[model samples]
Target: MERTRNSWKCPIFGDLNDLKDNVLPTYGDVMRFYEWTRHRLKYERERNKEPTYKEIEAIVVARLIEIWAKSSIPTVEPKRMKVMLQTYHLKCKNLLKSNPRIPKNTLEGFRLGSKALFDIAACKCQEFLKCACPKNKKIPARERGFITDQRTARQMVIGALDVVTTTKITKTLKRKSIRENSKSKRLKKPKHVRKS
Candidate 1:
């Protein structure tokens, strides 16, 4: 029998599906998802505290279920996942552009495939566990923070790929935005306390 090849080359969301189904998540799975948390939340890494093991484990079990659920798709090929992500990215970008008031900074991460994967991972983890997640019990402060961070990071990454430049982003429009922000900060001070 010809053994099937693995599609772990998808970078952010590997199609491992290696974890056992209907079983508790393992240490390795927790660690892997934690690393993905880092990948998706790169921008907020500075202020956000590192996630605890229980926090990751809480989400990892659903991830295992999500992965295993897809195991029957019969589609296991490298770069295939990447293409699917790109297609979805384009569709989302168009919808987001309906309003011009939104800032472009959030779009930066969307250009990277990692952002989509990060987003999908977050969604899949929660989606697969809708039935299992407690309906009445209130979530702890820490896990709530984790959920918020995931959404914030995904929003930051949802942007147009066309805007992506070949060079590293050194804040072209960001400089103007910073200046505007600094000016606004000064406006908040009472006139009596304002420094000429």
Candidate 2:
């Protein structure tokens, strides 16, 4: 009995037969890819009890290659993975730096930053995917949740920052009160020395 080789089927590119043979993938393809990966990651976390950093990286790289191969674009090389990942990280870092409301020190800030990083990663991935096939297209309205979620996360981070700032201000005010009370006592007028 001959063993049949199983062809890898990409959730995003498996059914894009209508696309021109030479045409690159559109924004729709990238968005579908992102959603697929997000679901796969969630499933992996639930089933395998959370993958380590290295495991996660391997999964992302593998998925990227699979998507590229399935797209039938001859120009996109596997070597581009490293560059794409680096660009993604750079974009995330720049986003974090540009937004001053996301606190870097608090737990809430860290959570918000992580969300922002994921949001930027999705954006960068889409950008790279679009470049691979060079097409002018707008993301569909139904798939615009990425933008909305990022905006909501930013607002939440701003709210968290306000809370942090208020607490810090209150602490400083308490310290100042103590110091001011001591200074006031020291500056009190000396008892009147009556000339007896």
Q: For model 1, what is the C-alpha lDDT against the true structure?
A: 0.40
Q: Candidate 2 — which residues are off by over 4 angstroms? A: 1-53, 101-196
| Alpha-carbon runs more than 4 Å astray in model 1 | 1-40, 47-73, 100-196
- Which prediction has the highest TM-score against the true structure? 2
Model 1 Cα lDDT, one tens digit per residue, 86-169: 455354446355535545554444334333223222222343335343433333332444344434452322122323441223
In candidate 1, position 120 carries an lDDT of 27
The number of residue pairs in model 2 that clash at the backbone is 0
- Candidate 2 C-alpha lDDT tens digits along 65-114: 54433322222343455455546545444644655564445534433343
RMSD to the native, candidate 1? 22.1
| Total colliding residue pairs, candidate 1 | 2
Q: 5 in model 1: Cα distance from truth in Å?
A: 37
